[model samples]
Target: MPIDALVYLSMTVFSLPIAGIRMFKISSLSLSIGMSAIAAAALTACGGSDDGAASTREVALEFVAVAGHTPVQCGTLVSGLGTGSAPAQVKDLRFYISNVALLQANGTETPLTLSANDNWNLTAGANQITLIDLENATGACSNGTPATNAVIRGTVPAGNYVGIKLTMGVPFALNHTLYSDVTTAKPPLDIGAMAWSWQSGRKFTKIELTDPEGATGSWTAKTFAVHLGSTGCVGNPATGETVQCKAPNRMEARLTSFNPDQQKIALDVQALVAGNDVTKNLGGAAGCMSGGTDPECAGVFRAMAIDWKADGTGTGLPIAAGASQTIFRPIAR
Candidate 1:
């Protein structure tokens, strides 16, 4: 008989709750069943399992943003731009990146478990993202935030990861929450300057540069701001309602052949603003404002490997192409 059957048979034989009476009632059937139950319990206590639950180990990954070889800073003049444009001084550079993952050698991606950093990261429940702030309003960058965040940290599965992958904007559901209404809104999202008044959404990437030499002749420092965000947003911001976006201009960055332990991921601003005119502003906006018809975006979006004018609609969401390369690259630490 089975162990369970022995337990049932012993229950019948033992008339009272006396311990010795139950022991005396043990027959061959009872011994086999009772021993089987005890053996199973021992196995459970010993942590014996056929499933591979203990294989994954905790891993930490760090992300960094840079300009050329140097770390990005305010008031620093960056030269070599599009069509002989003048040297530009960076005023501010803040952006949001989300959905971090580690690309394995077998072409499988392991999603990271993000721990929120009070200064740099924001995580409320399932939503976790990084706010990279690189300047303050001390010198020429008077409009920038003083709190700088260059390094973003997250935990991943311990293994030989071939690459790192991340998305460059807030998800559509959490993108349009108004600052005033959202008490939980953190740092970069809470900043008023990053909020778009027309669309009521956060700027995915804000890179502001000014020419220090007065070469533009109009202002002492002509502005070149690339505010990447969703356009054609429809809804109200006052009631903490998330608006529907026509374009969720979120760019995906995938750096292949990257080892987080040995290599550092670089977000080169030089490659970002490459082949883009800083001095000229053809439209009302000084730089590419994630607008479909903006002439400035043609070069800016192209260099970033984004399909700007897709489907002949003059507008499209940021699509990730495996063949096209982006500014985010892996370099030795």
Candidate 2:
């Protein structure tokens, strides 16, 4: 029953002369039952007010993977693509994306930590982050890593927030081998795997393109896997930690705070795989395969930013907020 209905019902049940009573104090059971009858309506009327108790808001962060589709997985869905019958399947694909950062309205950063066993908790506000999930994800790689991406939602006091900040993998500080004491001290969980080996450093992701010439045919049966991690990693002889090299491979994805009431933010993998990261700081082959000389792959690894445009569903990507996108197509720039 709604609050209005309950209120009406209570008055109707005891209608008549009883209305002369000064204070009609409600009993425990009556109060409980009456409140229960119309809780949702009451809350709606309250509209998350800060009267006796402060009202909390819940935030929903979803991930979508857009590849063959327009807007991928609403914008952050984890997935892989291929088409075939067993050996004919074009599943020879791999990539690395790490070091998550929140894109505030003004364009600041709220970096997060990712690794095998990371501390950044989705429920807690810790900078911990994880991937959503990939279809047919298996092997040691898929063992402990989260199959679901981190969600930062809760009853936060209603206020103005530009957006969130996070990263994809572990940083140099946490990359120190000394940090991995597997004795009585529990090994700190590192959320960025596939990019990290023990504690080398964050290597965002690896993009592999197979079918050399075309689909499963025409092209050679070779594979080109693009892996981005701190190269030239040297292990500390004493504590057994890997020190950071001068430069490391990385990727940066930025998205303005998606205004729930206004425009929705969308991420498209089709454009991403086909987009160009030609900025001086951002390098990568416009049409090159991975696996060659360090220099050959360096240029292709430079541009590692996934920039979502204003037109998510129409002009840019077809990704949505509630669902994720999964695709398997032969796409290129």
Candidate 3:
């Protein structure tokens, strides 16, 4: 029974001796025994007894952005990045994470039940996504909003979790929604800067940096943007057709040594662009946009451990087993 109902019952039983002692003529010893039995039953039903069911506890997975050893912030210059060791100003930094799970010593995976708030975190059926926005609107992050979120809050079964696994992209079902209609759309998905109309999906990652030198080349663009999203998408939901993409471009990270209480996930910008020259864009857009023919995506994909063919027909695919991602790593808090 509910706690309120139990309390009412207990009150009525206790008042019987004073108000209905003559009417019922019940013995004190019998009434005492009945009350004890009722209390025992309620305790068992409420699991106050020794039960083997595991309890769950709230957990917060923190994330941060860095360039080598320097912390990344909007308008702040992070040097020693890219192949040329070029210094660039932070512009934008945001990404989505989903399908979080905690790993046990024996490789058992337990899904982390997300705390949905209709804002940064949302859970629809089997899909749970959280937006990690590290950039505030201040400084060079003028295109972003003032609000920022970097922690993915959820609940996990109470146990010793030694590892963590998560996907760095929004699920396809929630990705193709009408993001432009912010009046009805939910937050995180409603962000205009993360939406891509061309692919009819949201940008999984928006990491942009401004090249200070603006080196002269075929592409003299000052901003080196890395927008990762699904490519070669066929069909449109707006037209009442099912949407699908050839390349999902979702990156999964599995850290076998992560401890949520003592460590944080660090997105190293220097490692992300270490193989490419930040001063210039070799071909296809200002920077890699998850294009098949883009030369700049090779380094980014390699760092993420995603496969990409150089023949211009490359579909962004997850690398083979045993390979690991370099962009996201576990660092001491």
Candidate 4:
């Protein structure tokens, strides 16, 4: 029942027997009690004081794979357009996005409260971060597990969010711990395909592509893995601990005009490897393994707006200064 109605009912019920008393006394007492009840009802209706608990609005961080302009899925073969462009099937697509914040019009960051669901996201401090699992173990993604997490759900202050800011890697504190030993480790870190090691840390972004040029549904296909993570770290793989990394490789994605409700962030696979030849293997492990020496790392890192050199590790310059503008784009309406 509404508080106002309840208050009125209570006042009437309590004053019924007292109605036979002196008229002025009953009126004065009723007036006093009625005023108090109305005041309490008004406070209850407004949900307490203004600063007690503000209403929260939900923001969804959605993920999708695209080749050129066509939407692609895990098992679908997407064709490229460049000289070495070849039809390739996505084997796995997963990444970690943390410390999500909403940009205010006055240049302030309001941290989002990530909904803690064991599958896709976990509690990181008071806030929440998400492990975006775009594909599961099917078709070319057979090596992966059968858990698809393509959306991140979280709550922010109810208002107009002008922009979105998120980190593309696990925080350093949570990054260095070993999932094997950690009893409370959650998804993304717990998933064997996503977690690399303590030295390398978690694969911040794992994008695996297989060339489907002449073969279909064959396991004997050449695969390329873009395993972006912390490299050049002094750590013990056995203990699952790392002191620090020479190259953090944590890419920051800032969308200046993204409204999480009205639009979604698109991680374009075509644009990410637009300059590379997905058909030909670059020797060793096929593609960039987040190594500084790997020739393929430069283009891939550059695509995400990271200033990476051929030998690995950035030039100590700011990432967004010379980063490529091809990889992360907003989804069309």
Candidate 5:
């Protein structure tokens, strides 16, 4: 019952004469106590909160793939992509992200509590990950799946968020696992193309582009691939042991002024390959594979603002400290 109705009923019952109370075989004090108990129970059942606390609000941070100012699609040609201004078709564009946070004006960061789902988002212990799939299984992106996810959905404490921060990789605890193990691997983690079995971890970023002419010069097979993952990994997950990596090539990006409501983060293919000729591969894998000594990785790492060393133990400088990642930037929606 409503509190007002309960109050009125209690007053009416309390005003009853001693004869009415005697008929009920209860004293006036006892009847008053019973009414008070009922009122307390009603209040408890109504979900009333007297304390003032900020409620959480749902946020869907948007993202997009672009080549310079033009939007990127599987079959469509992205012009002005590399140092050679190469026009190529996107073969694959997928990446994993974690540790999403919204920044406050006072420089405080509030973690985005991801909404757990079977497909895109998963939270295991202290790790929260979301896969951002920008390519559909069309044209050159046939290796990818038909489904695509371009937004990171989560909840954050209600406040005026001024910026956004995220890490472009899966967490260590969840990264090193068997991709073929169906019971253990989940949606985003179950993808075979993103798995690196030799390293016992995932390719944090799998970005590939192909020349339309099918040319095979320094760029053999007419494809330039940039696969980012932990390199120089030690230990074996197959033996049920923890894995350690010398260079966890996870890229971190932070936008000091981002409005999630009105802007979307854009990953520019042009910016990623601007420092190198995509048509040429000097050494190592066909393209950059997070190898510290790979000539192709220098340009990619420089674009990502990650310090690179030839010895494979290049986790030295902190790029995120200066917030200098050039591949991802906020654009008006």
Candidate 6:
């Protein structure tokens, strides 16, 4: 049979007029082809099904801002100064915090790169990392950019991490007096305190003490730097990041050990607010001043707060004797 006759006969058998059936069939097929073409096009635009590589695992570790020298409430400020008892009492309420790490329960720590370090001071609490490099808008802090707290890029293992840790400076072997300079390509390349302090070789942090009697604080302020090693800062004094002058690699620690069963670490920010209990761990204000109180640096460093769930500033209550530091995941997370 001819092709045209076969087409007509088949349409009629299906209980439809030949011409009408033929047009409907063509239109249906055309629509089907059009739909198929669209579907294929959509798939390609969506990065080509099954042709993509492994997905990158990353989590944004955001560091929010809170004033070190005030009560540190979310928006607490006064006379261009932030509200806080201890920091307000001190000459300058700033300390450098860098070399951040995201820890896993498996003893792994992922180090964070320096996002922004404008104005060069590392010790300012609001200086290191935060949501907005929010300024005090009052005094010396006006020109400074609050450090970036959010971890924009970091390699996260495919599991729940328990804690985080990092050395205070660049690794020892890579450090020198020059490394203290944070000039991008400097030897101590990643050292925060050294560069921030400028003069101190590798200061963990600096706290000033004033011995005077007056209505307002006196001008006789004594500067104390927390350097590596012991008094007089003997034995090379850890040029790079870790605890010393001449070491090979960065210090290694397990952040998971801090967490009990995947729980968060909640620090008693209230106690810190009351006045960092410098006496509890470091004996007295005098000892911490010179690292004179031996074997307590770790204790003091441990005393530094890093909670996961608490608000960046905490409840804003004063810390008490019974208050222990709490560490947990941040609520925003």
Give the candidate number with the greatest TM-score: 5
Q: What RMSD, rounded to one decimal, does every model reach? A: 8.8, 12.3, 8.9, 7.9, 8.2, 12.7
In candidate 6, residue 233 scores what lDDT? 25
Worst 10 residues of 6 by lDDT: 307-316
Indicate the TM-score of model 2: 0.46
Off by over 4 Å in 3: 1-54, 182-185, 213-219
What is the full ranking by lDDT, best candidate first? Answer: 5, 3, 4, 1, 2, 6
Q: After superposition, how far is residue 128 of candidate 5 from its true place, in Å?
A: 0.5
TM-score of every model versus the real structure: 0.75, 0.46, 0.81, 0.77, 0.82, 0.42
Per-residue lDDT of model 3, residues 1-333, tens digit only? 644445445544333345545534445456667766786687666545344444676889999999877889887778998888877877889999988999999988899998865679888778888999999987778888788999998998677789988888888888887787664346778878888764468999999988654344232568888888988888877777888887888888888899988999999999999888877879898878988878999898888887777775665677752157788888999
Clash count for each candidate, listed in order shown: 1, 63, 0, 2, 0, 40
Sorted on TM-score, best first, the list reads 5, 3, 4, 1, 2, 6
For model 4, how does the per-residue alpha-carbon lDDT over 1-333 read when each residue is reduced to its tens digit?
A: 654455555555333335557432234455667776777677657646434655678778787778767887777777872246777888888888888888888768898888866777877665456888788787788877687777888887677678877778878777765666556466656766677664636888888888665364333436767888877779675564446677777777777778777777888888788767765656545677777777777677777777678645474223763234576667854
Tell me which residue pairs clash in candidate 4. 292-311, 292-312
Candidate 4 accuracy as TM-score? 0.77
State, as a TM-score between 0 and 1, how close model 3 is to the true structure.
0.81
Give candidate 1 regions above 4 Å deviation. 1-67, 214-221, 237-242, 310-312, 322-325
Tens digits of per-residue lDDT, candidate 6, 28-128, equal 44455665677667765654534553333454443333233222321233212111232322222233234556766665665544433334323233223
Q: What are the per-residue Cα lDDT tens digits for candidate 2 across 141-226?
A: 23333244423333334445565433333344444443344431122333334435534443344333333223444433343334
By TM-score, the better pick of 1 and 3 is 3
lDDT of 1 at 299: 70
